[model samples]
Target: MTVQPYVPEPLPPAGIDWEAHIPRIASANRALARYDGILQAIPNPRLLLSPLLTQEAVLSSRIEGTQASLEDVLRFEANPKEPIGDAALADIREIINYREALNTAVEALKTRRLDLALVCDLHRVLLSGSRGMDREPGCVRTIQNFIGRDAQIEHAIYIPPAPEDLSGALGDWEAYLQGGELDVLVQLSVLKAQFELIHPFCDGNGRIGRMLVPLILYDKGLIGSPMFYISAYLERNRPVYYERLLAVSRDGDWNGWIAFFLHAIEEQAGANGRKATAILDLYDEMKQTVPEVTRSQYAVAALDALFKTPIFSSAEFFEQAAIPRRAAERILQQLREHGIIAVLAEGGGRRAATYAFPRLLAITEGDRL
Candidate 1:
């Protein structure tokens, strides 16, 4: 028997037992508030939290089967000319595009609301020059699509809305996004699930859906910026994440999914808070260490550049640190001697050497050296 495409109902689905979820809603809100406070306290969060963004991109793409790691992406970025095989290169490019797309969306949200147009633009950047570029980037699907084991629709585990009904369903989704809801977080949960079920684009739907999490929170004023990283939690609980989403369409279990999502927000917010705090602390420590190790007046500048790009080439560092070339070289030598920065590859002839800030990278990876 063939399964019909899942036609999602309009947003603000009725009959949700909101009262039963009061405790979870409160806890999630408190956790998010604490995280946001930390975000505001950090100086130049964009530079300090940069690694977390890359990790978010890596994990989000990994959920869609991308095989690149945070280190792989950074190393390849530091030296794109290195031959890392076609498959790995392709995966790294996708991961890079994820970060680029997310950054684009964050900037676009400053002047515009989170709507379909912005979302489509994000989709365009996400699949540009990657494997999914040929899947009609930045456009809604014109054909039926389904989630299943293989390409066969008969085996489809979850079929999204048919092509003809997509516009109406999406219009409702966008309107609901603009309208106010009692609980912004719950609204986010519904919006995310609804978009996935709608499956607007032929490719990059899952990624775009996940990208909207931080964007929505920022737009709703839940966070200072669109830097919250929830993918770490979602990726760890991959099976349950999908199960909760499927349960909504399979058994009309919105409450179940909402509960799961709220818990995700609560738990991930705490984890994100801890990571941000650690990164900030490391930044403070490096402030004194870089000066002590290199004994250079440009210590603060050098430290900031390293935090911005944990894995970078000698040339990149020279340019980013923006100090005299002689001072940069001496500082690099001192840093290497003191084990502050590990040389990933030695400089050869005219080729620049690559280096890694293991201590900072370790914090982002949830490990400490």
Candidate 2:
């Protein structure tokens, strides 16, 4: 028997049995709101959230088969001039691009609507200088594409709607994103799966679709900040994530899909909240202890820079930490002696050495990395 290509039904599900999943929906919303409440209280979200965002970029890219760990990324970033294998450098660049794309999208959402234009811009950023660059970085596909292990479309595991149907499908998707009667969480669950099925961009569609999760929730005012980290959950349950998505198209199981998605948001929200709270508490402890440890008037400035970067070169630190060269050198020397920062790699003769904040990296990377 010949296997036919999968074609997704249109958006704004005509008759979903949402009533059955009301309790689950409410629970997920409450969990998300609690996380948002925690995020709302953080005075400087970007500074505190930077590590989590980087972790997110790593996990999300991992789902797409990128092997760069959080440490690899931070280490590479800390010493970009160092010689690294071409493969590792490429993987690290993709991870960095993911973070850059996410930050750009979050900023753009502040002024403009979350429409196709913003999505394209994010795709462009994601593929720049990476392997996906030649696949039409910021544009929708103009030819047929498929998802599978084989190169031939005939053996594809799944095939999205034809290129001609994409415009109408995307227009409908954009309309739903604008406003909808359904609960935002429920609506978001549908939108993510739909976006994957649509596969808007020829390359980086999976990554861009995942990025839409936090962006949609934040833009819809469901979350205080766009710091949700559901990719951790999806990456852990990779098999089930794909299974549920395929079930939606195969069996029209919106209820099952939404339930699974809601669970991801609920569990990951609680986890993200706990991690953020821990990071914030660590920040406070450092704020008090760093000055005591360094015994310098510029300790607070150095502490702030460490919290923001966590992994940095000593030269970059002196310049960006905004402290006098001598003072900065003294502070760094003291920190090294006390083991607050460990030398990852040493540079000789006017070149700065790279250091890592062990506790901070442990918190961000967790046990997995």
User: Best by TM-score, which number?
Assistant: 1
In candidate 1, which residue pairs get closer than 3 Å at backbone N, Cα or C atoms, i.e. clash? none
Cα TM-score of candidate 2: 0.97
For model 2, the stretches where C-alpha displacement exceeds 4 angstroms are 367-369
Cα error of candidate 2 at position 96, Å: 0.8
lDDT of 1 at 25: 94
lDDT of 1 by residue, 1-369 (tens): 777787788789887788998999999999999999999999999999999999999999999998999999999888888878889988998999999999998889889888999999999999999999999999999998889999999899998888999999999999999999999999999999999989999999999999999999999999988988878888999999999999888887999999999999999999999999999999989888889998889999899999999999998899999989999999999999999999999989878999999988888988322
lDDT of 2: 0.87
Task: Report the C-alpha lDDT of model 2 over 1-369, residue by residue, as the tens digit.
Answer: 434555666667877777888988899989998999899989899888898899999999999998989888887877788789998888888889999999998889789878888899999999999988899999999998888787987777778888888888899888888878568888999999999988888888888988999999889888868778888999999999999988887778878888999999988888888888888898898988899999899998898888878888988798778999999999998999999999988879867899888888888878342
Task: Estimate every model's Cα lDDT from 0 to 1.
Answer: 0.92, 0.87
Q: After superposition, which runs of candidate 1 have C-alpha atoms over 4 Å from their true positions?
A: 367-369
Residue 355 CA displacement from its true place in model 1, Å:
0.8
